[model samples]
Target: MRSWKRRGPTYCKDTWGCPRSQRKRVVFNKFGQPIGKIGKKFTNFLGTVARLGAELPIDQFDWRQVPNEKKEDAWEVVQDYYDVDEMHKSWTLSNIGTKWKDWKCYLRKTYFDPGFPCTDDRVIGDQWTGLYAHWQSSLAQKHSITNKANRSKQVMMHTNGTQSFACKRYDLEKGSGKVLSRPELFKLTHTKKNGKIVDKA
Candidate 1:
């Protein structure tokens, strides 16, 4: 039996629930990168799809400018690794675009920054060698610094630690059996795991 899952955008094809046993699994290396195609985590598979399929300037390319053909191509690739149906194509396309943007930000923070162990090109391995050049470009550096400065000016920062906002919203909705309001989501996101408010002022 087919049923809609109330947890965020997870669409379950089962009547009981979308258990982990039903979903695709992914194998990861020590660096957390996917090792293969099918049976992988959705986000990692999507990340791999973006890295392999999309071709754009790493520094300042916009998703809006990406051709529909490219997105369609990406969608087809995702279908090979995920259980997503054709009915979910629109959502999957948008999700892919968002994931692509997030991947660029992550690459900048991980490879361009000073602290991470994966910052060095000599040991970054062949998979990331293509991105190493782009991250080293002056344009990428400018954008990274500008984005960092802008982020520092934001007052209401979420205290969810490693938990993503989507996951948090999904969990909250699953427990409550209803969609969360914008205000409720904001409050929950700003609250820490210890039940303390993140920004009291």
Candidate 2:
């Protein structure tokens, strides 16, 4: 034996009912009226077809053509977004505020020939030796020390391929002389015309 279920209403074939699952007792909004269902099914169908079409390997597609005047306006919009300060920071130089006359005098009196040295060949008594003695005396006066053994000294030398010279000094404890390094001596002898230090001969 089989039981038969009773059907309340047959509304599937009705054109004014639910479009997909056509029901007679259709749901409604606050206003008592039939709510149409055609728009939902149309939108769903179009979305599914678009998803399937995207899987195809289409190389080119048509885009709305932009005019030349509009393209230039778009370029200006891109340039306006750039940061001004970050772009110019690396181009700036450090300013030490040293006077030009003082630097020139220091170079002439401390390193040049005929300034302190009697002649170029006299090694024991040269411009550098006098500069070192003056530096030692300055240090002694600053520290108020009477003994020469209480001073500290430093020296840097600069050199080229063939010729070299002593160019820098401080003051040494218990020593009556100056010293120089290869790089500093090179700068005093072979500098650029613009007063920039040169690394190579």
Measured by lDDT, the strongest candidate is: 1
- TM per candidate comes to 0.55, 0.13
lDDT of 1 by residue, 1-201 (tens): 998765322222231234434555443333333333332245534655555433433333668877777777887666555556565567557766776787666665665576354543322354355556666779867977898899899987888664545666666776889988878999988987789887876
Q: Candidate 1 vs. truth: CA RMSD?
A: 12.1
Q: Tell me the spans in candidate 2 whose CA falls farther than 4 Å from its real position.
A: 1-35, 54-58, 63-201
Q: Candidate 2, residues 1-201: lDDT per residue as tens digits?
A: 898986432222233233433322222222222123432222122222221212211111111122334333332321232221333222110000111122223433455534454242312244335534544466635643543244343223233221212111221211435444545544555555577654532
lDDT of 1 at 63: 82
RMSD of each: 12.1, 43.1
lDDT of 2 at 115: 44
Tell me the lDDT of candidate 2: 0.29
Q: Identify the leading candidate in terms of TM-score.
A: 1
State residue 36's C-alpha deviation in candidate 2, in Å: 3.0
